[model samples]
Target chain A: MLPIATIVFREFLEIALIISLVMAATQGLQGRIKIIMLGLGIGFLGAAIIAFFTDTLAASVEGTGQDIFNAGVLFVAVGFLSWTVIWMKHHAKHLSQRIHKVGSEIVAGETSIWVLVTIVALASLREGAEIVLFTYGMMASGQVTWSDVFTGASLGAVGGTVVGVLLYLGLLRAARRHLFAVTSWLLVLLTAGMAAHGASYLIAAGVLPDLVPQMWNTSHLISGESLMGEILGVLIGYTPHPSGMEVLFYVTVVVLIALLMYRPWHSKAVVAQK
Target chain B: MRFSFPMLSLSLLLGMMTLAPMAGAEEPTYTLEIKDHTFSPETLTVPADTPWTLIIKNHDKTPEEFESTELSREKIIPGGGQVRIKMGALKTGTYPFMGEFNPDKAKGQVIVK
Candidate 1:
């Protein structure tokens, strides 16, 4: 039962962190909660379907299907997140000045809301499927009773959600005035992390090379299996020993997003005009 | 501003294409099997500083995730299914892996020497 709880907790925590970040980031937007909830619903449904098709998915693409599928999901999430971060940069000024007006306009405009939904959905889909598959395996194996599974799952779910809530509240309190800037930057890092994660999957699938295998090892200081490692991994793409390809993907996304957001070229052109 | 979206996607495509697949078919291959949630040949020995392919076959009636933090590789093997994971060249050491669904019962190690 304890093992079951631990596994569920680890998976749930990853999903919870992503959802909480999105929720906190879009705090001022009207109907954002409903949109996020809708995404969760869709994600749960998708997870069940994916879990059911595990065997087929595993066998596809000459047995590299699972890695390819995971990479696809991560890349899709990265795309949505990058779009949202850049979009927010353009509208944040209006969002701060007239919260109510811009909030409604954001929902009514539909693009940002859909992007939010897609991000939330993709975040939940991968982790949620893992949880579903794990619990189902436990039940099917008959090594654990139904009550044990239920109790453990509930405990894990509650524990993960409480942490997510704390994170959301903390972000709100800490960055009230600079909420947009803080969250946007956070999203940028999160997007980069997702890209690196996707690249890792591609490397695993043999679709890409690792370039150099182990850049450096910090597992002695912080094992990837440890709780701290997991949190930092999700939050900032911290890997104790990242592959060369993973580092490249992470750096590329960060540089790309930074360039797009700041647009140093625009400033240079303005200076030239002066 | 509008051009940025196209630029972003185009760059992504270009990046992917440039990093074309270079996984050699000549790399050494190893096999691991999972039965009753336990790894057969729980300790696999391989040459150090050499990349290899690990083919994991799960004969269980339920899915298992093959995870190795040291290797930085994780993949799910469905019931009665198998997966091929490309492992990087490693220095001499012991790298542990486990079936995440049954971590306590399904544990193994890779010894690179």
Candidate 2:
């Protein structure tokens, strides 16, 4: 049950991002739909391949080994994705203008529309790939139902599409400015939590000894595997009591990355105006 | 502090190989006796990368399941019978085997030297 909830939450976030991007390309950019769909199909294929491999590899390494690998992957991915999100928010206006200029310049060249189509398609595909990896990570943890993940993903995509369409139609203009900001911060939190989760798994595998055994006892309330913890676990990488290094990994990574992003584009109006 | 990369790997590899008694290329045959629901000589030493057969003679009255998640293999043997587990030149590590029915009493460790 807890696993189901976890799947739903992760899928919701992933689908929301995908829908937002698709809508942004179609309505916002006044781009061709056929090209975008083509890109999505390609992305789906790539995602399927990645999902298959990640599943097989994860199965080969369970308990301790599985946990360490998951944590490492999550750390790197979160770092990369967070960086990309921050970059996009800071430069979206400039990027859009640049893309429009490039599009117009190459409009006279051989199939400029195809280039734009390819660009949007590739971006969407990248997002799809991330979704596959993230979903696999959640499943490998043995905490969620496949049904919950699919259902959540469907709902999230639908909701995102609606919001994206609204944004494209100029119905939800104000929301766009802060959307990336909110998502970026949430990602920071999630990644930090993942670090701790990874540490715990390593401890379980005996790869790393419990330097500080029982960071804090939560058996009285909700054990680590409880439904509540599972939900929190997926949402923010929650741990009942974390070790010193685990806490350090969580706090330092999230806070440091957030700090790096906050300084340059902290002002909503400034970024939105650009 | 200034150890060359290849040299470092060689040293570690050599150390591990020496530490693991069953890690030798030469295959060795041994008998594991299970009497009174306990594995005799709980620790079996063998060289790594050496193919070996684990002959389990269960002289107990009940059944026992020899399970190893790491090895991805499990075999069940009934009372008054013997079973064979083929360790095909196993990797250099301790492969833990347990009896599903009597886990506490039916515990044993396979050490790859």
Candidate 3:
């Protein structure tokens, strides 16, 4: 039961961190909770379906299908996150003002709402699928009883969510004026991290070159399995030993998102200079 | 600074094209099998400073996640299934791996020399 809880907690931590960041970033958006809940529902359904087809997925594309599928999911999530950060940058001020005037019920256009939903769904689906597969395998092997699985899973979920809640609260405590800026930058890092992760999967699938496969190794200093490593990995895409291609993907996404969000051509200073 | 969207897109495309995989010398291959949650051979040795392919065949009745923090690789091997993992060149050291589902029982290492 302890081991099961540990594994589940590790998986859930990633999902929890992502959801909390999105939740904090979208604070005061009307019906955001319902939209996120819907995303969770969709993700849960998807996880079960993916687990059921794990064998087929593993066998496809000459045993690289799982890698390709994972890469696809991560890349899609990166896309949604990039869009959200940029969109929020444009409308955050107006949305916050409306929230204050309307007393906390501000609808941020349907398109943005759906974008958040998709982002939440993808995050959950990626982590949730692994949990489903692990538990299913444990059950099939008769190594653990049903009650133990339930207890461990519940404990793990609660433990992981508590950390995420703490993070959300910390974000809420930030100065209101700077909260959007902080969350937006965090999302940018998150997006870049996802892109780097996706690139690693493609490299694993032999679809992309690793470039310089071990640019550096810091595993002795910080093992990837450590709690700190897991949190940092989710927050900033920290890898103890990252390939050159992974670094390239990370930098590219960060620069691209920053360019899109700031849009220097539209800056007041640039326009004035022109 | 005027950065045209077209130029940005073009640069991005060019950058990605540069990442296209190059045909390299075939990597050495090693096989590891799992039965009853334990790895066969328990330790695999390979030449240092050369990338390799690891073929893991899980002959058990349950899925196992082949994980190695040292190698920075994680993948699931379904019951009675096999997977090919592309390992990076190593620097003459031991990289331990395990079946994450049964870490205590299923463990192995790759010795790069």
The best candidate in terms of lDDT: 1
Task: Give per-residue lDDT, candidate 3, residue B99.
Answer: 90
C-alpha TM-scores of all predictions: 0.92, 0.40, 0.91
Please provide, for model 3 over B6-112, each residue's C-alpha lDDT reduced to its tens digit, 9 standing for 90 to 100. Answer: 24433543454344333233778899999999999899999998878788899998999998878878899999999877777778989899999998999999889
Best by TM-score: 1
Q: How much is A97 displaced in model 3, in angstroms?
A: 1.4
Tell me which of candidates 2 and 3 scores higher on lDDT: 3
RMSD of 3: 4.0
RMSD of each: 3.1, 14.4, 4.0
DockQ of 2: 0.03
Q: B1-113, model 1: which lDDT tens digit per residue? A: 33354356446645653453445489999999999999998999999999898999999999999998888889999989998888888899999999999888999999999
True lDDT of residue A99, candidate 3: 86
True contacts preserved, each candidate? 0.59, 0.00, 0.38
| Tens digit of per-residue lDDT, candidate 2, span A11-50 | 4434334334333432223344655576567657865664
> What is candidate 3's lDDT per residue for A228-266, written digit by digit as tens?
998989998989999999999999999998998898867
Those runs of model 2 whose alpha carbons end farther than 4 Å from true positions after fitting are A1-64, A92-177, A217-229, A262-274, B1-113
User: Per-residue lDDT for B69 in model 3?
Assistant: 77
How well is each residue in A154-197 modelled by candidate 1, as lDDT tens digits? 88888888888888899999999888789888878888998999
Best by DockQ: 1
All candidates: DockQ: 0.52, 0.03, 0.35
Model 2, C-alpha of A222: deviation from truth (Å): 6.8
